[model samples]
Target chain A: MNEIKIFSPATVANVSCGFDVMGFCLDTVGDEMVIRKVDKKGIVITKVEGFDLPLETELNVAGVSAIAMYNAIEVDFGFEIEIYKNIKPGSGIGSSAASAVGSVFGMNELLGRPFNKTQLTEFAIKGEALASKCEHADNLAPALFGGFTLVKSVSPLQVLEIPTPEDLYATIIHPQIEIKTSESRAVLPKEVKLSNAIEQWANLGSLVHALHTSDYDLIKSALKDVIIEPHRSKLIPLFNEAKSSAIDAGALGCGISGSGPSIFSLSKGLDVANNVKANFENVYADLVIDYDIHISKINTKGVKIIG
Target chain B: MNEIKIFSPATVANVSCGFDVMGFCLDTVGDEMVIRKVDKKGIVITKVEGFDLPLETELNVAGVSAIAMYNAIEVDFGFEIEIYKNIKPGSGIGSSAASAVGSVFGMNELLGRPFNKTQLTEFAIKGEALASKCEHADNLAPALFGGFTLVKSVSPLQVLEIPTPEDLYATIIHPQIEIKTSESRAVLPKEVKLSNAIEQWANLGSLVHALHTSDYDLIKSALKDVIIEPHRSKLIPLFNEAKSSAIDAGALGCGISGSGPSIFSLSKGLDVANNVKANFENVYADLVIDYDIHISKINTKGVKIIG
Candidate 1:
């Protein structure tokens, strides 16, 4: 009998000012992937729950990841992968990333962990590229390094593991609305105003410094996006109102989760996190509020195997 | 007899990615202000030099800075300020910043150093506000800090002083051409595509990481600007050739200096700096090369009193 393995962890991509260059793993609300060696020289995937995901080699997130990893290393191993999808897809919770990352991570362990974190991240990106049609490291960094990670550079893939502050709490509210990555991406303009770009860089620079020095106030002030958020927010109904409520309820910063419909907030304490979660609930009363409020700390461990 | 007083070093506003929010002071270039107390309770301008400068309060950089400072702080003391400008006006080398910063520094000393670096920087920003008609901190931070400084936040005006690596050499080539800040500002688009913004953020994040770790290769890779440099490059004659020459001569990175007309290159050693300078000289033989080929070290000391 083949053994069953599982790897799961939540992830936040496009972290506040970092946009595509930063992300982090959370202790809860992630996807689990189980892989077992098969006799045949081909890959197979089973999507178990939460997301109505596809099972085809190219369409399935886990299958794509497994195939990319195997092909990149020229491995002829056949494997059957199962994605126990916990995080809702299109919820800005890195749902797809969890599957992709989990598959790569589990397979890497099954294959004796031949690749490093970067190599794993690259494999994860290949999966993401198939889904999003663009290679981005935002989700991959956190899924690999764990905790609060900065994808400092994508090509040659540099990941910096930022020290997560002790008082930090994340309050994630999923509004159960679908905002496809492609559609969310379409609303944004092809060119950004120089003024907006300057502000973005300024905020991003401050955000990096804040993360490095653990300056909470700087983080609060720098959690602004004049570039992508404004247009992307328009796609999500009551997005601005939800964000405003979170801020008023004592969030250090709040923005659309991943790409939208799901919103996340960083706060100083559990009380603030609760307040922020309640605020989001209050604002979007009509929507299905799946409150995954976590006073939980950053996940220093990303994807890991469970037997 | 008139009292001799020295002023703050003029700064290069917007150190590439840190536009409007980041700046650094240069030791070699600045403006000098000599202030002697007079019987009248109003600022009296004695002389202004270094390019055809305007002495009128609204039009003059130093005059506007002095006016803003006096108005804000309600200083009743009158003094004669003679400006000995080393940084040429409209040279994209923060010539106007030097004047404004010089005025603030000179006045602060004349007022018995009543303000700290932060306070002086705020006062200097009055100068920047007057010159650019926009409140920006990039030039002021460098003028006040005197090194590769990062403006972490502009509103509460937080600045982080980054240590410049010892092995770094800066080769600045002033082509003697003029590109007005207004024109440069106008040429850039108001809206950038989401993809381009992502790339910009990626590069910017990498650059910050590079700066922190002193990773020269990462810095070289991260110095790319897909947003402003390309559009602004058109205005600067032989910009492409100069950049190529500088890079071929062993510079780590090359880009437009501040706005344009002046281009700078980051190199590893004195040999590289000399080689870069020689290359620039060879390429643009007719244009008088103002090669500021100096060892690139972080300016630890910002503005100081010199008698």
Candidate 2:
């Protein structure tokens, strides 16, 4: 396949109890990309649509990630890329990750799958680092491997694909406010109470077990964040109200997705997910802030060919 | 079933990355107890053997736990308990937990099993608090529910029983040194680095996932302690050497079992577990320190009726 068209899904990172390590893919929201092998010797971004992101190879996440992948292998011909962005940058829904994963996924497909998903993740994070300002695999892993992912360690780049329950769905509400990743990280304390840390890890452990067993009640109980959310949620408008509304509308759990301005609620079924979305919409409707809301099933396929 | 004699299993809590939350039962190392109903008004420790322990109801963990259970229930009669101790106190194994669990379990059995294991754990922790100076279900949950357990929460207590892989075994080496629970706890920092906390939770989440899927390699990778072990291991003699020897002998992972002095290693099979035990024996043999070592399969049944 000399030319490839692929849909790269968006992702939710720092999933409540699983801060800095866990994430899940969203099926309905993503970025579409088209790539073609050319006789050129270097990576190039031919076009970017729907968002005025940087087109320069060094500045754009997609270009940077593709360059990382390209430099690692001996490819005589280079690739030209076109990105159709749907996920807003800094929406707290892994916008950069979608772009980063899209380019490498397409390249790997064109190269007859030379690299594995883990290697693709490694390449993708190089681009992701430009956005997050550090190497983190929580978003990149899910965007590549799909479903739920737990980044066991960043240094070793170990990512474990946790099972996604069939009925699980996510409702996301993105309030039109920019919370820069660096700024969001700044609000967090360098140290956390050891007791709270223990509670957080216990919740994380149980949440992982709940996912494997498909135990909704356990999931409800386990999806708590005692560390990062308290500090970061202050930056988001009506964060508590949105979370409460979603939970009251039958979401299993609700929390600030990634660094915020976006809040995510997980529910067991599509109907509940829709209910959560409606509640989120209601939460933002009275406010002057512009917002976007979506309901999505768990995406089992990360980045896949569309044409 | 008015009177019963039972064997209560020992447990290794704080399993590597799972400090303050996780534990598993041991098959061969435990304590024995006999509990019988009487028309008396309150819990009574009728006899004590195999070790010098408090026979007073309030001072004895079994009696304290039995009283807790007794106070919660509408029992017409009190209970008599006789102890035959096997697990050594302050060995970093669940010695107090066995006694605490034994009384409540026997009472529940004699009463036609009115309280569930979770409720029994609630009563058991009342006694465990006497030993550890806090209510922790890590050891009690495993000693009651058997196999592996994660105490997700201490307040409004929630315990999750994790599946034990059929081939899994534990090798425990107890060095004859005293590390009081309070002293061990005092060694831990009140706060930890947020980065380290994230790493710990990630390992714990992955460890729980590994247990559910029976992934040995994942377990091996996930069984890491980055938070509490650094401070607590200093209290244990030859902690680093013992861990290295265990890993060198094919153990999946090794760390301070509960607090200090005792170290536990997990392996995939009986042969490797035995090898780990032998290596542990070798580590302490050349030194002047006396040590005890035992290898046992994962105990799926916790406290059980013996006669």
Candidate 3:
């Protein structure tokens, strides 16, 4: 297969109590990419559509990630990538991760599946760093491995693929307000109270167990952020209102999606997810900011061949 | 049942990454007690054996826990408890928890199980506070719920009973050197770095997932303590040597059982657990301090009736 067209899914990072460690893939929102091997020496970003992004090989996430994977393999020819972006950057729904994971996934498929998911995730992290300004795998791992992923250790890059409940769905709302990655990170405290940290880990542990057992009630109880959200939520407009509305609408839990300007909520079924989406719309309609809402089932398959 | 004899197992709290939140019950190391319904209006400790402990209802853990459960119910008759203790206090093996849980468990059984495991744990925590000086349930939850337990929250009192693998075993070593609970508490930092907390929670989340999936390799990788172990290990003599020896002897993971002086290692099977026990023996043999070691399977029944 010299050419492959694939769909790379969006992801939600900093999942409530699992800040900087846990994330899950989304089924509905994503980016479409086409990659084809050519006789050229290096990677080339031939085209980009739907959103204004750098087409240069070094500037674009797809190009950078593709190059990372490309340099590690023994290949005589280079690859060309074309990305049709649907997820907006800085939307806090892993727009960069979709582009990052897409290039490596498509190239791996065309290269006869030369690398495993972890290796692909490693390559994707380089691309993700281009947008997020850090090499974090919470989003990249889920985007590569699908389902819920836990970045257990970053130095060793060990990620655990947690089971997603059958009825689990995600409702995401991206407010059209930009929050810079630097500012988003700057809002975080360097030190946290030991008691709060313990509570956060306890909630995270319970959340992982709830996912394995498919206990929706436990998920609701475990979906709390006592450390990161209190400070970062201040950066997002109407974050409190959005979260409260989502919870009232029967979302199992709701919190800031990534950094800010976007929020994600988990529900047990498609009906409740749609309800959460509607409530998000109701809450955001009163504001002047333009917001987009998407309801998606937990993506069991991360990047898939489309053509 | 007018009178009943029971076996109440010891437990290991703060299991590696799950500090103050996770614990598991032990099958071999435990205490025995006899509880009976009496015509008296309050709890009575008629006889105490094997260890010197206060017989007063307010001072003794068993009497205190029994009173907590007894006060909540409208029983026309009181109860009599006889303690036959085997576990040593301050061993970091939940000796206090055994007595605390044993009393509530036996009282509940005699009272036709008026309380659930969570209610029993709440009562047990009251007794555990007499020794630990804190209201925590990591030990009490497992002693009552059996298997593994995660104390998600202390305020509303939530505990999650996690599944134990079929082949899982524990090796515990008590160095006999006393590490005061106050000194242990003083060693912990009030605040921790955000990065370390993230790593700690990540490991904890993975550990829970590993337990659910029964993946020994994942458990080995996930059973790490990045936040609490470093400071607390200093309180225990030869902690590093014992942990290294246990790991070298095929233990999956090892850490301070609760605060200090006692260390617990988890292995996949009985043979590996015994090997870990022998290694612990070798490590502590050079020290002048007297030490004791016990090997136990993961106890599925927390407190059981023997007569």
Candidate 4:
């Protein structure tokens, strides 16, 4: 049977230092899609569930990505996909990337694996562009390939797989609110001081080195986000306080995940991650808004065949 | 018999993509210093040669760095240093850094190796501050540690050693012209577009990853310097044609070495480096000004105790 189900993990873009170039996957949250072959020559969206996203093939990422893949392959085959998105859109944790990646990942398998992971990512980017105006691969690269990924350049479509330390844990807090990606991006300064930019580049270089070497102290020193965070942190309530609390609770570094309404803290171990989660809970204790806290290791596998 | 001689190699800072954050040593040109213990508690510069640099202990980097190291030790001991400078001053190949690194490296040896390399780098930065207002280590760190070096952070003084591939070679062209570092810096824009800054950061992060993984193609793609070169290249004569010639001649990437007057090209093999050197020579052949060409492997051993 030419049918398969693909599960695409939720991804975190920006990753603190790299604004539009860095991303990583999380195993705890994801989206699933079931794809099957048809006798026709176009993509068909059978169902869209878990959110009020569009069902039209041109509007939805799942259908749009499948169509993009079909266009690239130019084959006389059709695909029908059922989308089951779990990550909420506008949560700043790469919600659309899951749907976009799942579609092409499932379709590629249904077509006898016609495209590589990188090629699938390109089609997924087309889907992401259909939904979002920006043509970024930070989320798409991680969602398609799993683990940590660096989209060094998008034109030639170069994606690098970064090594993740086994003991490193990620703790995320998603507040029940919405901060549109466009609005979050619009608030950033059009011009940045060259001195600050130099510092940022230095930190990004250091962070990459730390990730490869598994140096905990270097990670802490290099986790700072001076440019984007200073402007975007205004969108989230108690972002600085929560970050401070997480650091006080033994977290290595903490910052806003993606744009806002969701914050993440990276810790050295399970005990520290759990303690940092408790600290986050303390910061939002009296708040009336609902929130959820999830703790897990960095996902090493991106999209996988489930059934 | 507490006497030592240290050879500190010339270094290329900025490395095209990482302005003020990256640097590497050259195997061909360098500075040598001779240091010996004295009976008193004050450092002295017994000899200064090669260039018109100051011989006064507080005026020259060799003497200033030696005094800085002596003060840090706070021991009832003194040292006398003799400088045999080979790297031309203001040539953009870390002329001052070679002197500064050599002084502390030699003093540490005479003091029975009191400080580690990192501690020695701190004293060397103080030496650099004596000549230049900015306490930069882009050149000094690599001069002391050898190989490719990253000045991760200057506040607490963190320098990281980046891995180098075996086949990597460097080609340098030092046109006999003077472009002061301050004037080169002054020509740059005080603020850069956020988009350009993001691109620069992405490139820097990619360059570090490429160096670690030895991905030569990625290095070539990420070696674009959009911020400083566009402004500073105007000061250098025949900059673009030489760069184009080197690239066409098989150099992986080429750019201004530090501030100006000296330019470097990185190539995959020794043959390519030599050919790129010839290409640069051809570009400058029509010019009436005197120029020098140097082709060498990356100096992985930074500074060494020569005698």
Question: Which candidate should be chosen as best, given lDDT against the real structure?
Answer: 2
| lDDT for predicted candidate 1 compared with the true structure | 0.74
Better of 1 and 2 by TM-score: 2
A13 in model 1: Cα distance from truth in Å?
Answer: 1.7
- In angstroms, give how far residue B129 of model 4 lies from its true place: 1.3
Interface RMSD of each: 2.3, 0.6, 0.6, 0.7
Model 3 over residues B1-307: C-alpha lDDT tens digits?
8999999998999999999999999999999999999987899998888788999988999998888888899878999999999998888998999999999999899888878999998998899888777798988999888999999988899999898989999999999998877788888999999999998998899889989989999999988998889998998889999999999999999999988688999999999999999999999999999998999999988889999
Write model 1 residue lDDT over B1-307, tens digit each, in one string: 3365875675655555555565656665567777676777777677887667766666777777777677766555676778888776666767777777777777766677677777776766777777677776777778777777777656777777765666776777777776777898888777777667777776776666666667788778777778778888899878899899988998887887688667777777779888988988878876554444333334557766788
Model 2's CAPRI class? high
- Which TM-score value belongs to model 2? 0.97
Ten-residue stretch with the least lDDT total in model 2 chain A? A177-186
TM-score for each prediction?
0.89, 0.97, 0.98, 0.98
Clashing pairs in 2: none
lDDT of 4 by residue, B48-162 (tens): 8899888788999878877777777777778888899889988889988898889888877776787999999898898888767789899998888888999988888999999
Interface RMSD of 2: 0.6
Alpha-carbon deviation at B290 in model 2, angstroms = 1.9
